[model samples]
Target: MKIKLFFLLFVSIFSNAQVVINEIDPDTPSTDVKEFIELHSNIPNFSLNGYVVVLFNAGSTSPYSGTASYYAIDLDGYTTDANGNFLIGNSQVSPTPALDLPETTLQNGPDAIALYLANGSDFPIGTLATSTNLVHAIAYSNTSTTQPTALMNALNLTVCINENATSNAANHSIQRKADGTFEVKVPTPGMNNDGSGIVFNYLTTTFNNTSYTEGQNVIITFTTSSNVTSPVTFTISLNNGNFNASDYSGNTIITIPAGTNTASTTITLVDDSLDEGDEEFILYISGLPVEVVASNNSILRRVEDNDYQISNFGTPLAPTYGNVTPTIPTGYYASLEGLSGSALKQAIQDIIANPAVVHLHSYADIWDIIRTADQNPANHSKVWCMYIEQPMSKIDQQQGSSIVGKWNREHIFCQSRGGFQVALGDTADGISIWNTTSAANVVDGISDAHHIRVENGQENSSRNNKNYGTVNSSTVYAGPTGTQGSWKGDVARSLFYMAVRFNGLNVVNGDPSEYNGSVPSGNIGDLATLLAWNAQDPRDDFEMNRNNYIYTWQQNRNPFIDYPLLANYVFGPQYGQPWFASLANSILNTDEIKIFPNPASEYIFISGIETPTRILIYTLSGQKVLQQELSTDGKISLNLPAGIYFVNMKSEEKTETKKIIVK
Candidate 1:
């Protein structure tokens, strides 16, 4: 009872002459440890009975509630020493004879600390207060915008200090000077303020390369002069990057011992099969001694893709018009030997969609594949454009060189026509100048490979989203603009391959202009025109070679190129027939047959036959127009206007067919 009475009397005597909050240490050297608040009184031996310190998080207001105040430290029997210094808070090492307020959790500021005379109650921490019992309040922050303004006017506080501008929160404390000025200084708990501060003599940080492969350990080091007084320490985090949290892990805080001033940290990056390209993150530093100045605040680290070896891909077979010697790389279709037509199509789709086969590759890797596939072996450094045959250019390692000087990857089937995106296992995204542009457009997310081709920029850009056709009559101009020949068959087959490979809402199923909800889609562009083009242009040596090369890296064959009749078998008039035959044998044996007046205006003549046999002339549409018995050395065909015609000759043993173009 006597002690309680004395507490009341002591509070009454000095409640008005309150001690001031002189210094605050929110963040300390070792993580959350060593946080403290210092109080000083002008009057010596001042008792702090019945006084309480309440801390509020940022954004708290004057009318305090249960949630407003984060913590309240009661100072019932504490008093200032003879030197008029009183300290509260804890560190790893307790200051001798200091009042330890371990329950007070002072955060890295932008917070408010309030002193109130409790008047002998449990100190209404969660309740409202007036200026009557309030002693002093100090609000401070490293970031001015984050400083708490609650109860400032009612408590009659003179100023709110933005301390972040003045000091690094790591190892420094906000110091109140004898002249009543605030500055960042070395922590001085329970002692009078001195002007001394911490300092680092020298500091530097650097990275060997801005880019790195994912799943590899990246080492970054910081060097400083040995003139350091206190230990130098800082923190780091992957502030921003197009990568997952699980992709990387590293030490956040780096420390150099008091005697030394250099340290390094290793960040291990995890590699996934995503197609994101060239991502970046920041490495930050803080907590230098007050005197130290950093050479640079932060550095950027980039991550490159290393999931696949794109540069060392195999080459395509040589240009063979219709030979089966290179026999589709043994075991290519070993699993689908028996099936034919649509069933074969489905089986091939499943095989291509297998995870092991659809390997993830970078945009660069795809472009390199294009360079190898599209190169004119006669001149290894030059490439032949798919649609525009004569407009050849030198092959540069980098894409997007000038239109006439360099080639770009052309997506025969425009990527945006369907919403297909590219990523690890999914195909949607690059080669040529288009490849360079694609590489430039590469981002840190899933995108579709722009089923590309090696064409000049003018042709590629002009062909943007337009369906293949004779340029003048087409809805939008794509493909060979002016009489530069047409790759209608190649375009149709590439789109067909894409439809089979990728089947999603935005891909095979997503045809805005025309919907033919069928697998191995023939609905990409104008289907009728594509079929006509397939019949008109037919597959040439260049296209066959490209198909072979694409098969080599991509591990899937274009059924259209393998058997033009397969187009009829799968999507043509003979839709669901199980009869499948290899055009390879016929193509190989066609050297014996010869037809003159090719691209003939009036009539075509056939020669070099064993005997006079029955002669037949059929259009590419499978319409037999002329059937007559040949009179001399297989001579026939006096009529037939302008179109592609397949001349079939039947003798005693076997029949041979040869293609002839009519002008």
Candidate 2:
């Protein structure tokens, strides 16, 4: 069970000058922290020039066993410390005192690593040249899982060290002993491996929170199985990744007095002003008291960021004032200014893609976004729904929860059409909008606020995934008929948003179940229909609230709702013109055109025309109702209906469109 002394001597004497993989920490507590590998050299002033570290993954075949997905770090610029130690870790770790490696380099277990010297020759996996100047190589695994048999077979026999130890899920590292055998040990990276440290076989260490807001205190505790006889002191160490030691207020060590079974420490994190992703730090314990062994030695803390939650300067009240304009953050839309048409749309797309504009939330918490973000300013008791213009009770904001026949969160851009992941599915496969532990629906992508809305349950089911157009008996459903007409623009804009936001190369190749690849490349919906809806409906108070409310949670805006004219430039009649416009272009001549009783209810007289003119009348929704041809100097009288209408008169010489009010 012990390492061979001769093997140890060979390694310490011959491989010390050359870089060796020393410490490897995988299976950290939090998902965001980095997995790392530490390297050490026995020779002082050892320059790592011309050397590189490589990782070969587990469960691979021949060429793939060595060549498939490998991470390499060139050691040309790094030098060993006075103590003969150097570190090359994943990019997740901020390398101040160490060299950096890509996060993709290391897997949790069943993996192999190799160190080689560069002699201007290819050293890809499965290549015999890789063994030419091979300095050191190693393999390790968690005994409980399947062993890395394929990786072990691929490594060059010239130099390979295999460790027989189970992987630890509590962020522990497997290290080499002085006997040339590998074992789980207290990581004293950059120092000699004398194996003098605490054993936590009888105690458990736990952290209160895996994710925290900056400036919040991180609390951790150590508990013993039974009472201890004498006082015990444990040396604690902190390793910052994307954070600095100065950001916290705490000591590196804590003590547990005699007769006490538990001890705790508090580290307060300082809040920073920059908008950034989550950062992390590690807490390690050493020097245990008498007759104690560590069940867990280290814990990771992830600091969730909130610097991008800037206010939109609008009231959060529901039954919101219909006319209050939504405000975008200062300089947030600066990049989109001046660009028009397709160019402007692309710029807007780039703006929304900014990390600062995204708000990552558990699917379970989306109820708050729907209820609180879109609340009525006139009444705090109800939240407005896009479908019916009616306020929904605040109590119906939970998973599988509803107010009988009232409102629920509806995916206006059908979940299946977009294939966004919600909480109910396998999150590991891709992004999920729902919380891992919550019962929230996963069909909606997480942190995506623009595509969801409050709607009556029946209405949501009826309108599901049906394309917008003229509806009939065969159509499974028609959109909400009440105030829903007013929301056609809002609905169209939201659908356009989904098309732009999710249009990209699929993250999971060949998986049409995802949003990006679900529809054919570069297409979200019928462009012509959407453009017509945008032109006809225009923006209303309800649509404004929808934009402003969603922006508060998502940190982005619907540019079309903000500026309707952009739709023409992006998907104009010329580019995405609806089928109704089958005629070609003609000149517009307004001279000598006259009509009497412009607002007349029954009829209107047209005079002063040399040639026959074709007249076409259309509703605001772009629906053409009447078409007729008039002779020169014609007086027209006919049964006219009420409401707003636009009249287009065309001839060989000229064409003109004027608004006709039939009161």
What's each prediction's TM-score?
Answer: 0.38, 0.38
lDDT of 1 by residue, 442-502 (tens): 2311222325677766667666666554336445444554644545566766665555555
Error of 2 at 508 (Å): 25
What's the C-alpha lDDT at position 623 in model 2? 64
Displacement of residue 81 (Cα, Å) in model 2 is: 21
Counting clashing residue pairs in each candidate, in order, gives 23, 23
Stretches off by above 4 angstroms in model 1 are 1-327, 334-341, 391-405, 422-451, 476-489, 504-522, 528-541, 581-583, 588-663
